[model samples]
Target chain A: MTAPLLEARGLRVTRIGDAGPLKVLDGADFTLERGEVVDVLGPSGSGKTTLLRALAWMLPDAEGELWLDGSAAAEIGARVWRTRVALAPQRTALFPGTVADNLLAPWRLKVRHDAAGPDSGALRRALDSVGLDDVALDRDAAKLSVGQAARVALVRVGLTRPDVLLLDEPDASLDGDSAAQVASAVARFAETGAVVRVRHQRPDGTATRRERLVAGRIHGVGDCE
Target chain B: MSEAAGVVTIEWPQLLLAAGFMVVVGVISLRLALGLERDLALATARTYVQLFVLGLVLRWMFGIDSPWLVLAILVLMVAAAARTIVRRAPDAPKGMLGSSFVSMALTGFIVTFAVTGLVVQVEPWYRAQYVVPIAGMVLGNSMNGIALALERTFADLDARADELLALVALGASPWEAAAPSVRTALTAALIPTINSMAAAGVVFIPGMMTGQILAGADPMKASAYQIVVMLMVSAATALGSVLAVLLTYHRRFSASGVFIERGLRDDIATARAEE
Candidate 1:
C-alpha cells in the first residue's frame, strides 16, 4: 500500500497515578485510506479518544507521531495538515452565532480552504439532508437544542471538508433518532472518501474493533464483523 | 483662645447649625434610600451610625494622645473591613480569605504612605488626622476594588470554562485561555473607582473631599487630600485587581495543563448544580 492518506505508529499514552505510570494506550498503530469509515470500539479506559487526539496533532502531552500521507504531522505544515485533518468532538461545541455562521466558521480560520460561503444550493441540500429547514440558518445558534447544535457542528466541519476527520463518540449524547441523523451525516461524509474515525464501548467493556481500532495494540482488527 | 491672635472665638451656635444640616442630609438620604426600596440604605445607615460612634471614640482617642490607642482603632477598622470583604467572597478558596484582606490592606497602606508621606509630606506619617483619614480612604476604596476583583476573578475562572477548554484544544496554552476573561474581570472590578476619578467634580464631588471641607479643613487642603486619595485609589485598585486575578487564575489550569472541571469554571455550574 503506497502510504495511506493518514498513518499513525508507536502511539502511547500514560498518566502518573498514585501507584506509577498507568498506561492508557500502548503502541497503537492506525492507518486510513481515502474515504474509509473506521469505528473504534474499546473499554472505558482503553484510550480511544486519546488515539484520535494524537492523530489530530492535538494532545500535546501524549507521545505520538502522525503522518498525513507522507509528511510527518509536525512537519506537514500546520495550516496544510489542519485543513486536511479536523476533529469534531462528541459534545458539539458550537459558538454563539447564527446557524449559518456556525456552519461557516471554519472558513474564517486561516487554515480553511472553503472561503466562498456554502453555495445556496449546497446549503439547502445539506440542511435538507440533515432534516433542517432554511429558516434554521437564520436562528441564533446559542438557542439551539443539543440535537440542532450537533447537526450544526457536523455541517460546519463538512463545510471545512477535511481529509481525515476524527470524531470521538460523535453520537454519544444524542437520542436514538438524533444519533441516527448524526450517523447519517457521518456516512455521507464517508462517501466522499474522508477517513471517519469513531469510538464506542463494547458490551463486555473490553477493547474490540468496531472497525480497525483493534489492529495494532490488541490485534483484533477483524472483530468489527 | 484669643481674638488678637486671629483665633476668633469659634461660633458654636453657627457650627451647631452647620452640623445639624449635615445630620439632616444624612437623615434625608436615609429616607430617600428607604423610599426607593434600596436595601443598601439600611446598610448605609448602619455605617453612618457606626461612623457616629467612631467619631465619639476618636474624640476620646485624640484626648488620650496615646499612639497605642489610636493604633488599636486603625487595626480594628482594617480588620472589620477585611472581614466584610472576605465574607463577600463566597467562592474564594479557604486559604485566600485572610490573605485577600491583609494583602488589600497592605496595598492600600503602600499607596497611602506614598501620597501622604512622600508627596504630601505630612510631618509624621502616622499623624492620626492625616494618616487615619488617608489610610481610611485608601483601604476603604481598595476594599471595594479588591472585593470586586477577587470575586470577579474567581467567578470568571470557574465559569466560561468551556471557552477555556476550547482555546486549549485549539492549541492555546491554559493561561492564554484564561487571559481574556481574567482581563475582563480585572477591568470590571476597577471601573467604579476609575470612573469616579475620571468624572470627579464633573459627575459628583467625591464624598471624602466634601466631608473634609465640611469638617473645617481649608478648601485648598481638602482638594489636596482629595487628589492624593484619588491617585492612591487608582494605584491600589490596579494592584489589588491584578493580584486578585493572577491568584485566582492560578487554580484554573491543572498539573496536566488541562482546564480542570471546576478549577477554571465560573458561576454557571453552581447555578446549574443548584437546579
Candidate 2:
C-alpha cells in the first residue's frame, strides 16, 4: 500500500505560560492521503492552531513523529518540510508591498529559490480562482478590505503549491460568497494535493473526513456527511 | 603652568567660586520642590572625585610608559563600559555582558589604535598619554551606541513578533526572519553619531576640540584632530552596533531555525532570576 501523503504520530507541544510550561498538544495522531480534504474541528484554545504550527515545524518546542510522502520529517529537514507543508495562519499578515508583491513574497526566499516561480498569468489565474478578479494586482495590500485580504492571503498560500495546505480558519473573516470561493479553492487544491483545515464554524466545503481536537488529543468524528 | 603659550590656568581655590553657581541651581530646585538637590549634590561630588582619581592614575601610567600598563587600562575601560551598557538595557537578554564586552573591546581598541598609530602616528605606539584618552573616548561613545542597538533590537523583536513568525512560516532562515528588526535597530543606534557629525564645529564645539583649544593649541590644529575624532567615533559606533546585533539576533531563534517566542521569554526570565 502507498503511504499517506502526510502523517503525524505522538505530536506534542509545550508552550511557556504565565505560571509554567503548558502542555498544549499531547500524542495527537493524524493522517492525510492524496486528493483528500480533512477538516479539524475544535473550540477556542483547544490547540488547533498549535497543531498546525507544529506540523509546519514553526513551533520551537513542538516535538513529534511526522512523515511526508513516506519520508521522516527529520530526514526531510525543517526548511524542505515547511516548503512542502505550507501554513496559512488565522490572522492575515501581509508584507509591506503591493498585492502582487505579497503574492510573490515566498518565491523570494532562498529556500524557495529552487522552485519554479509562478508567472504573472498564473498569479492572475490564482486571483480569479479565489474570487479576487476585481482587485488590482498593483493595489496596496494594506488597503484591501478584510474579505478581500482573506482571499488574497488564500491565493498567496495557494501559489506556493505545497503538498499539504494547513489552513487556520481561512474563511473566518470572509463573507458568504467569499467563503464559498475559499471552499472551492480548497476543493480545487484537494483535487491534486491534500488539505487539513481548522475551522470554528462549519464551512460550505465538504471534507473526506472530519476530526475534532479536544485537549490536545485527536478524536475521529466519522467521515464527511 | 606656563601662561606664555596663551594658556589660562585657574587656581585651585577658585573652584569654590564654581560651587557658588551650583547653589543658584540648588535654590531653584528647592523652591520648586523639584527634589533634585540631593542628586545634584551627589553627582557634583562624584564628578570631582572621579576626575581627581583619573588624573592621578594617568600621571602614574605616563611615568611608567609601559605598553602592558596601557593594555591593562584599556581592558579595564572596556569592561566598565560593557557593564554599563548591559545594566542600562534591562530588557535585553541576560548574559549579554560577554558579547557587549567583546563588541566594545574589539571596536574600541581597533579604532583607538588606528587613530593613535596610523593617523596621529604617536611615537612608541602605545603612549599612555595618547592611547588612554583616545580609547576612553571610543569606549564611551560606542558603549552608548551598542546599548541603544541591543535595546532597540529586543523591543522591535517583541513588537514585530507576528511579522517575524509569518516569515518563518514561509521557510525563512533566521537571518531573513530577523532582517527587519536588525535594520531598524542598527539605524536607531547610528542616528546619534550621524547627527553629532553633522553638528560638529557648527552648532557646538565638540568636547575634544574645546579641550584642545583651552590647552593653547592652534584652532586649525584642534579642528583637524576634531575631524579625525568625529570620523573614528562614527566608525566605532557603526561597527559596535553591527557586532551587537549579530550576537543577539539569533537568540530569538532555535538551532533548527524556529522562532521561539515563548522559549526566548522563558530564557530571559530565567536569566533575570539568576541575576
Candidate 3:
C-alpha cells in the first residue's frame, strides 16, 4: 500500500460572502496516485476551482489536512507543497513578456532561485509537447490568443516538474484539436506524475478515474463512462 | 501689523478682504446652483480657525522650548498624520495604524534631524522652531505619500488577483507575488514629489522660499533653504512610501504564503464574532 502522491483530508473552505460565511468546500477527502489522470467534474459553481485552489494553498482561509509523499503538508510548507502540486487555474494568466519568459517564470521565483531555468531547446520541446511548436519563443505572450495562452500556461506549469498537476477548465478556451493535444500532453504527464483536471468534456480517454464534486464534497462517479 | 523692510503688513482686519474673495466665489456658486456654497463657507471658517490655533500652539511651544515638549508635539503630529492615512485609505487592510505611525515617525524624525543638525547646524539640534516646523513639513508630505501608496497597493492587488495567484501557484513567496503592486504603488506615490522637485524654481517659487524672502531674508540664503527643503521632502516621501508598503504588503497573504482574496476581512470578522 504505497502512499498516495497527494491527499487531502477533511478539507474545508469557508469564504465570506455578502450574506456571510459561505462554506464553499466542506470536508473534501481526495487522493491522487501516480501514473493516473483523474477528471474532477462538477456543476458550474460546485467549488471545482476552489478545490484546486485549496490544493495549491491559494486560499488562506481554507483549512485542511494535506499530505504529500507520506509527509504532513505543514512540514513541507505551502511554497514547497505548491512546487510539488502545481495548479494551472481556469483563467489563463500570462505575464507581459515573451513566451520564453512566461515559461521560465517559475524558476525566477525566490523559492526556485537556486534552480537554473530551462534552456531554449527544452522550452521549445515543452511547447512542442503542448502543440505550440508554431508559437515562437521570443513572441510576446500577451499577443497570444486565448487558446495559445492556455497551452503556454500548461507548459509553464509543466516545466515546474510537479508531482501532481491540477488543471481548472484548461480546455474551456481550447479548440477540439488543441484540446486533444492538451489531453495528450497531460497523458504524457501522467506517465510519470499524476493529474487532476476539471473539465466539462468527457475523460478524453486518458483519465483512469472520474469524481464529481457535489455540494462541497467529493463523491466517486465509478469509472470514466 | 507693523511693516518691516519694505514688506507690507496685513493686520487681522485686512483678512476680511481675503474673505471677500471667497464671497465672490460663493456668490458665483449660488447663482449657478453649483452647490459649493456650504463647502466654501466651511473651508473658509476652517482656514481661519485652524491657522489661528496653530499660531497659538506654535507661540506657546516656541516660548517653552523644552525638548520633551518638542518631542511630544512631534509624536502627536505623526500620530494624527497616521490616523489620517488610515482613515483616507479606505481599501487598506486592517491593522495598518502601526505601520503608518512607524513610517511617518521615522521619516519625519530622520529628515528633520538631518536638516536641522547636519545641514542647517542649529545649535541645540532639537530647537523647537527648526525641528518642529521641519518635522511637520516632512510628516505632512510623507503622510500623503504613504496613504497614496497604500491605497494604490490594495487596489492593484485586487485588480491583479489572478496574476498574483498565478505567481503564488508557481511557488512565489508573498513578497515575490506582491513585488509588481509595490513597484507600481511606489512609483505612483513618488510622482508628485518628483514633479515638485522638477518644478521647484522654474515653474513657481516654493512656499518656503517665498516666506523667507517675504520675512526680509537674503534671497540667496532663502534659495539655499528652499533647496534643502525640496531635497528633504523628496527623501522623506520615498523613504516613507517604501517603509509603509513593505510593512503592510504582507498583510495580503498568510504565514503559509497564500494570497488572501479579501485581505484578512474574513479573519477580522471571525475574530470580532468570537470576541
Give the DockQ-based CAPRI class for model 3: medium
Evaluate residue B199 in candidate 3 and report its C-alpha lDDT on the 0 to 100 scale: 91
Report the C-alpha displacement of residue A142, candidate 3, in angstroms: 1.4
- When 1 and 2 are scored with TM-score, the better candidate is 2
Better structure of 1 and 3 per lDDT: 3
Error of 3 at B59 (Å): 1.2
- TM-score of the A-chain for all models: 0.84, 0.95, 0.95
Q: Clash totals for all models, in order?
A: 7, 0, 0
Candidate 2 displacement at residue B8 in angstroms: 2.3
- Across residues A114-199, which tens digit of lDDT does each residue of candidate 1 receive? 45667667776787776566446778988887777777776666666777777777666667665666567776677764644565
Fraction of native contacts, model 1: 0.02
Clashing residue pairs, backbone N/CA/C < 3 A, model 3: none
Error of 3 at B217 (Å): 1.0
Taking chain B only, the TM-score of every model is 0.73, 0.93, 0.95
lDDT per residue for candidate 3 within B42-117, as digits (tens), equals 9999999999999999999889989999999999999999999999888777899999999999988989999999
- lDDT for model 2, on a 0 to 1 scale? 0.86
Model 2: per-residue Cα lDDT over A168-191, one tens digit each: 998899888888888988998999
lDDT score for residue A194 of model 3: 96
